[model samples]
Target: MNAPPATRGGSALVVIDMINTYDHPDADLLLPSVRAALPGMRRLIGRARDEEVDVIYVNDNFGRWRSHHDELLAGALRGPHADLVAPVRPDGDSLFVVKARHSIFYETPLEYLLAEYGIGHVVLCGQVTEQCVLYSALDAHIRHLRVTVPTDAVACIHPDLADAALRMMERNMAVRLADSGSTGLFG
Candidate 1:
């Protein structure tokens, strides 16, 4: 994983809270949005891979302090949205960061990892756009990382809330609002 960085100025793709068990109360509400964004997520992921951009999965620990990445994947695969998890499962080459909170950088080595690779730009994609995505974007901004969130690649429970969050990100953090197709990782 210590290879030279890819993409312009060491950019990375951060996937947040996608490997979920969907056993919670809000699971049903979130599922539809996730399904809607699945294709875009897949496209962005493929582009990142093809462009040799770093892919990082910043997933919630789900209160499992000792749980590993495989355990989380297995749990999600056994629950709802197995289809989603199966297709987007992190491969051996992908990096995984177990986050306990909404922000990926909070209590995680994400900052150091990005810094080690000299990654200054992050393209965020995954579930719950209004919460995890919003918070992580803010945290990224605070850390001086150029943030970009492909709107179609992120899922949210409420469309209105998602729009508002995206607007806030663009206005406050100066985050680049883009779609999977408009994101030019290689170019």
Candidate 2:
């Protein structure tokens, strides 16, 4: 497949489904991985901000149709794992997009937002590498956006599935697989 035309604007860091309440099924299984990935996520977010890159958080809405970004954040922060949510909480300047399903772009304004920002590349991070992250990467790829996923920055419920997902992303979508400390990630 041909690459999408490059945009003049720089890369954006897209945080997917990380601002979570962890109240659902499989939460127990996912928590350990989330804990392990926290530091990497923190580093990437810090670097993205330091580099003046747009930090866009695209999260699942948990079926709260009337809720907004702040509400979702507040709920997550109030959950049992507030410690986890606090470190990567969205700042005042961070862009927020609410998603209903697996893919960040599904029925969301993310495509328009990226276009408005002239973003041609997206660095994806956050939970469920085999699910949300994987689907989001595919969506970004088809949309012609260059995709990157820092392996260490994504959490997964099942390690084996997550590994397969990462490999699929790299092989099929041409996604750049890097660690959170990789330089120029936001370039």
In TM-score terms, which candidate is top? 2
Q: Residue 138's C-alpha lDDT in candidate 1? A: 97
**Per-residue alpha-carbon lDDT of model 2 for 1-187, expressed as tens digits?**
2323564346999998988999999999999999999999999999999988999999999999999999999999999999989999999999999999999999998988888778889999998999999999999898888899999999999999999999999999999999999987876
Clashing pairs in 2: none
lDDT of 2 at 165: 100
Instruction: Estimate, for each residue in 87-183, the C-alpha lDDT of model 1 and write its tens digit.
Output: 7788787899999999999999998899787788999999889999999999989877789999999999888999999999999999999988884
Candidate lDDT (C-alpha), each: 0.88, 0.93
State TM-scores per candidate. Answer: 0.93, 0.96
TM-score of 1: 0.93
Local error of candidate 1 at residue 124 (angstroms): 0.3
Give the distance in Å from residue 51's predicted Cα in candidate 2 to where it truly belongs.
0.5
